[model samples]
Target: MKKHTIVALVQDRPGVLSRVIGLIRRRGFNIESLAVGHSETPGVSRMTIVIEWEDVEQVVKQLYRLIEVLKVSDVTDDPVVEREMTLIKIHAPGPKRPEIVALSEVFDAKIIDVGANTMVIEMTGSPAKVQNFIDVIRPYGIKEMMRTGRIAMVRGVRGHNAEEFVENANGHAERVPVMN
Candidate 1:
């Protein structure tokens, strides 16, 4: 199955997230990563969803069936900027602290906190870079790690703007304006 990244714009009301997730679950598409948050528009939310599926066109259509889903776009093939943030707590003995610090510096990761025996590093970058950092630091012993799933946006002027989609008189979504 090919990996696909799709973005959705939905209303930011209670149960909307649950409804969207439920719809995806019912469609039998396994989500690899999901990141959802408020968008530039006040009452709208944007979701970046990564899924492994044979055909993503069907998935996009299924998502649009949800009333809360205003717009959906498959951006996997688009020129986009993708990012993920991770916090890693690694074993950092006094003797190995400097080496760890230097390695973090090389990866452009930040040492956000330092305990006597451990250090918390914050890394934000493309998914591959984040994985490379984790692989390099694994020998030092990772105590705990948390990663914010992939979030992406199309590059340049073409991007998703929630306000561009509006509900028409028939209660179906229609593009009312173009947002550059």
Candidate 2:
């Protein structure tokens, strides 16, 4: 019932993403947000997945069974820096441009482009901040808006690193996060 954010480091190859998605679908887990991109290491990809599931540990274990998946971590409980980017196009005429620009400044949003009657605002922040900005700009007649999937990185020294996934003497896999 609660949302869990799982980050997985997997081999970068064709069909690997589809395979992961298929596995999640077969298990009946609904993905709330999915963001995948290149990882720190070449030929490896990082996937940030948000799903509403209780058995997070089970899911992580299942993911490890997949050959492409190199590491998995449930970052829901970890202290993390989560961010999302949103671009909002608002109907801002000459008279309303100043007011809208001021409002965007208050939220640390940037006015990327301005046309005759519309302006595009770009912002990056937490989900709550993004929602608040949207709420405030709703009255201004939004022309269009788009948002990127959530991306996160754990705080402090302990994080989702390649070194975390270590092979034991017997050749079994184990994760040992370096604790501060």
Per-model CA lDDT versus the true structure: 0.88, 0.86
User: Which candidate leads in lDDT?
Assistant: 1
| Residues 1-180, model 1: lDDT tens digits | 888899999877789889878877886778889999987766678999998888789878988888778889999999999999999999999999999999999999999999989999999999999999999999999999999999999999878776675556654446566556
Model 2 has a clash total of: 0
Tens-place lDDT digits, model 2, residues 45-122: 789998999888989998999988988899999899888899999999898888899999999999999898999999
Candidate 1 residue 79 Cα shift, in angstroms, is 0.3
Give me the displacement of residue 25 in model 1, in angstroms: 1.6
Off by more than 4 A, model 1 = 165-180
TM-scores for candidates 1 onward, in order: 0.90, 0.86
TM-score of 2: 0.86
Lowest summed lDDT across 10 adjacent residues in model 1 is found at 165-174
